[model samples]
Target: MIEIVDAVAWLVDLEVETVRTDAVQSFVKQETVFVEVTTNDGNKGIGYSYTIGTGGTSVLAMLREHLLPRLIGADAALVERVWFDLFASTRATTVGAITSLALAAVDTALWDLRCTRAGEPLWRLAGGFRPKVPLYDTEGGWLHLSTDELVAGARASQAAGWPGVKLKVGKPRLDEDVERLTAVRDAVGAGMDIMVDANQSMTQAEARRRAAAFEPLGLSWFEEPLPADDVAGHEALARGTAIPIAVGESMYSVAQFREYLARGAASIVQVDAARVGGITPWLKVAHTAEAFNVHVCPHFLMELHVSLVAAVPNGRYVEHIPQLRAITHGQMRIEDGHAVAPDTPGIGIDWDFDAIDDRRVA
Candidate 1:
């Protein structure tokens, strides 16, 4: 039995080489709270908490003051049970962002340790049914870009062999949003899949209005058109339009995700292993989506998600945003617009302790 010996959290700031802008937020740097767990046997596992802007500090506090103590001396092998206990112990506070983000850090670290001990990659440890997951590009079509830029970005993704490209929507003025969507679709032609994300910027009425306009474009899916918590709003949009609705990054638990699925609120379900409270619940959520016959397209952490998606029978597509490319050593591979998971043991990442040096807080 591998008992957890110690744990620590670090704040990592990865310099963003590109100007990432959208209706919801702007980013000059990507900051994450990374968790490092050590076992009594001298093995170490790494995990991270998602959310780039402000919540990272609170996540760090929760991990330091709450989760790490509960986990120490616990068997790392039984990750699922521990995850359940930890989540249940916080019944009063377990259903929201802080709990999920903190739980994700601890849960992900346990999975990392489990796979490392087994001497196999996470995807293989879980199950290696599929080796490659289809890809899509997201960062290029910033909302601040001009219409010509949008077209250029879409065409570039197509020329590079990607099956799909996602652009941000929710321009304060709805007509400008329509023009940009039309320009990108026309430039990319009918061969490629064009998707738009509103980033939860619009009200229910505005989202419905915009979805109506994009319906004729044959968009693959309209992502996060309404606030994630607005289940009735999303259901209304889904019923009102032919375009499938996609959401998950902001959602924290299977119970929360279940609300959307059970209500027929979302057609495309996105589960980020990092954001959904670790590999245990993440797998459960994926299977849950499967039960509903809904396609599962994970949000990010592609290098890690590829193995997960490949393992799941209902796995659809893995989001391929180049956010981690600039900092990580030997990032995931993109070929003909799809990515194949690495066969190497564990999560297939060797944390560059150097790049993440500054974010370390006692």
Candidate 2:
């Protein structure tokens, strides 16, 4: 059995061209918490988790103070066991962002070690359902863009052969949101699939109203119209409208996803590996969605989610947002509207250590 000898954690800050806005909040910056674990046999694995603009230090603290110490004499291959130990050690923080994100980095690092030991890529090691998965564009759908800019962005994504485009809703007026979606629909035509996300900024009444207005437009799905915790509101909204309600990015555990699925509150499951406590629990959530005959189109981290989505049978779409371009040596392969899983051994990202070091803060 390989024992973890050393574990290190740090923070890296990444910048974007402009602040990315949605219906509820603005993206100030991306702070990624990186973890590297070395095994007794001299094998190493690197893993990371992300935050919008805050809490990276909290995640690092959790890793350094409590979680990393647990790895000292533990079997490196016991990913699930290690994950549970970390979860149990920090039970007070369970169901919260900091605990889940910290566990993600450790669990992911262990999985990376497992895949490396087996000499197999993560997608194949996970299950190998498909080599490639279809992708949809969300980078062009920020809430602050003008009507002209929105239409142009949608057109460009369509021209790039993306099968679908997601637009942000929840403008001050319902008509304004409808008008923007209508413009995009007209520009992209009826054949291209369109989705909308409100980012949990609306009330049940307002979400119902928006769903009614959006029903006739043939949107593929309505994402997070109401708050994520409002299971009753989502169920009511789902029953009232024909559009599929998508949720899960804000949820921190598989149990939360179970509540949404069992109640038929959300039709589309957007499970994020990082948010769900990494790939171990992520696989549980994905298979659970499969049992209910629902599709999984996970949120961000396209570089990693492409592999997870491609590994499961019910996997649907990968959101096209490359957040690691500046720190990774390679890019996700996209051809004919699908993102191909990387064949390299271990987790796909080849971290550029020098660049990451240049930006490291902790």
Candidate 3:
């Protein structure tokens, strides 16, 4: 046991080169909440979760005032124990968004510490399921983009050898949504895979309407046309849509995914490592989905997802969003449409702490 440790947290405001918009929100900035823990034996590891722009400081306070006190001088190797300890402490409200989000911050940090001490990369520690993963680009739709900009973004994805791209839908008027998809489809031509995400911005009625309207255009899937929490609505939309129904990303917890699976309401699953309490639960969700014969096309952070997705039989696609490349030491690669995970152990990458943000003792 590398005797228990001390931890620290930092915040970085990562920039989005272009306005990335979807049904529910718009992003021009990404705030990465980074955590680093160091053992008495001089071993250190880094982990991070994104809060985008909300509740990050509140999370920082919770870890310092609550979670970190229990962690110090504890066994560094007891990653799972720590996960459960933190999770159990908050079980009453653990199923809620903030609780899960807080657990995720600790969960990711623990895994990073474990893998670094073991001298293995995160994917390998995560069970070395697959060293590379198939990827789909998420580009070509911002709320304010002109038709040409959207089309060009889609074209860029194809030109870069990406098989598919997700376009933003959920314009207030269904006709506007229809035109956007139509132009993007026509511009990208017949061969590319075009997926649409309403970003959980539409009402069930609106979602159902859009789904029916786009059935003729041959979309790969309709993602979160309604909010993730609306399981019953998702079921209804899933029934109405010609394309597969994809949801996750915003969703937290295995139980939520279990409900989604049991309802048979989702065909394309999007799990995020940082969102579902880190790798441990994320793996459970992937395996759970495997049992149902559903595809796990995990959300962003392709570098971290490749390992988990490879470990399962039903894993499908990794969303390729390159926002973190500037700060992460190892940038992800694409080879014939598959993303090759970095060769280093424990996520095999380093965050440029100085460049992204300054560090502090948590």
**Every candidate's lDDT:** 0.82, 0.92, 0.78
Tens digits of per-residue lDDT for model 1 on 1-362?
Answer: 88888888766666665787888898756567778889889998888766756667788888888878888888888888889888987788877788888888888788888888888888878767787878887767788998988888778878888888888897888889889988888787888888788888999888888888888899999999888889999988889999999988788888988999999898998888877888888899989999999998888677678889988888888877766655468788777888888777777766666656744543
Off by over 4 Å in 1: 358-362
TM-score of each: 0.95, 0.99, 0.93
State, as a TM-score between 0 and 1, how close model 2 is to the true structure.
0.99
Ranking of predictions according to TM-score: 2, 1, 3
Per TM-score, the best of the predicted structures is 2
Writing each residue's lDDT as its tens digit, candidate 3 over 80-99 gives 78788888877667776666
Which pairs of residues have clashing backbones in candidate 1?
A: 11-359
Per-model RMSD to reference: 1.6, 0.9, 2.1
lDDT of 2 by residue, 242-329 (tens): 9999999999999999999999998999988888889999999999999999999999889899999999999999999888889889
Which residue ranges in model 3 land beyond 4 Å of their true spot?
358-362
After superposition, candidate 2 runs with Cα above 4 Å error: none
